[model samples]
Target: MGRRLLLGMLFLLSVKIMAQEKDSRLCLGLNYGFGSEFNNTDYTFINHFYKLQLYYKLSETKHFQYEILIQPEINFAKHQLLNFYFVKPETPDYQQKREDYTQLKEVREYVLNLGFLVRKPIGKSCSVYVLGSIGPMINDTETERMSKGFAFADVLALGFSFKMKKIHFDIRPEIRHVSNAGLSGKNGGYNTRNIEFGVSYSL
Candidate 1:
C-alpha cells in the first residue's frame, strides 16, 4: 500500500510539472483524511480514507470545469457495543438474547468509490465545487465470518480547490453516505455517514 501511494504521488507530480505552461490542462491530485465515525459510541474505533482526483477545465473565462474523484477506504466500527450498553435485563426473550447477553463485536469494511464534480473557479487559483458519485464496494465482517458486495450507492460532497501556476492543490471537506445491500438477506442495509477531508497536488 505504501509503495502504491508513493508511486501514485510521483506520477501526479510529473504530470503537474509537464503542464505548468499550458493555459487549459487537466490536473491530478491525492487526498487523505483522519477522523472518527459519528453516532458511534465506540470511541476506540477510528476511520481513515484516501482519494485521487482529476480535474479538467471547460472554459477558462467562465471558470467552468469537470472533475472525477476516486476514493478507497477502510472502516473499523463498534456500533454493536453501543447496543449492548443500552440493553436492560427486563427486556423480552429475543431482545435479551440479541442484546443483554450478546457480545460486542468489531467489524471491518473496505470500499471503493468513483465520483464526478461540477466546479466554478472563484479566482486565478481557487474554485468551489459540488460532487456526486455512485460505485460498488466490498464489505467484510471479520467477527461474523461474513463478506458482502454492493453496487450503486450514492455520495454527495462540497469543497474547494487551489491552483498556483503549474501546480494545483485542492482541499475538499465532504460528506459521504453509503448503503450496503445485504447478501442473500444474511447481511442487509447497514448505512454509514462520514465527514472526509482531502488534499491533492497536480502539475
Candidate 2:
C-alpha cells in the first residue's frame, strides 16, 4: 500500500512540473516590413511598414500541443510619392474643367489592431502560427485623395517562432486590407502584402 501511494505522489509531481514548463503568459514583440503600393490611389506611392505587438496567452492544450493567444498590435507605414498633385478649376474660355495634379511627398499611416493567434509547436523550441485581426486605421494626410481616418482594417499573417530562454523570434508574411465600406464614398479600399521579422519576450 505504501509503494502504491509513493508512485501516485511521484506521478502528480511530474505532471505539475510539466505544466509549469509549458506555461506561457505574456509576450511583447516588434517587427518591420516593406509593402506593396496602396491600391485605388491616383498617384504612384510606395510603402514601408513597421509594427509593435503584445500578446496574452489564453489557453494551452497538451494533447494537441497548441496554444491560443490574444494579440494587440500597432502598425505604422510611411508612404512615399512619385508624383505631385494640385486641383485646378475650369477655365472661363474652355467648357471642360481641369483635373487634379499629382505631387511627390511623404505620408504616414497609423493603425491599431486586436486579433487572435493560434500557435503550434514544431520542435522543442520552435513553433508555427497564424493570426487574424481587425482594427481602425488613419493617415497623416487628411485629403480625400488619401485614406481617411477611421477606415476599417483587417489583417492575416502566417509566421514561425523560435523560442529561447525567455525570448521568441518570429518571421511572418502578412497581408493588410483597409476598406472604406459604409465609411466613405470618396476613397476606395487598399491592400498590401509584406514580410516581417519580429522578436518577442515571454513573461
Highest lDDT model number: 2
lDDT per residue (tens digit) for residues 40-78 in model 2: 434454566666777777767862333344343445544
lDDT of 1 by residue, 101-158 (tens): 2455555556666777788888677888898877776655422213344433466777
Q: Indicate the residue-level lDDT of 170 in model 1.
A: 57
Please identify model 2 stretches exceeding 4 Å from their true place.
1-23, 38-43, 63-101, 142-147
- The list of candidate 1 runs beyond 4 A from truth reads 1-25, 34-46, 55-63, 75-78, 84-105, 142-147, 151-153, 186-193
Clashing pairs in 2: 83-103, 83-104, 84-102, 84-103, 85-101, 85-102, 85-103, 86-101
TM-score per candidate, in order?
A: 0.61, 0.68
Q: What is the C-alpha RMSD of each candidate to the true structure, in Å?
A: 10.4, 6.5
Note the Cα lDDT for every prediction shown.
Answer: 0.56, 0.64
Clashes of each: 2, 8
Query: Judged by TM-score, which candidate is best?
Result: 2
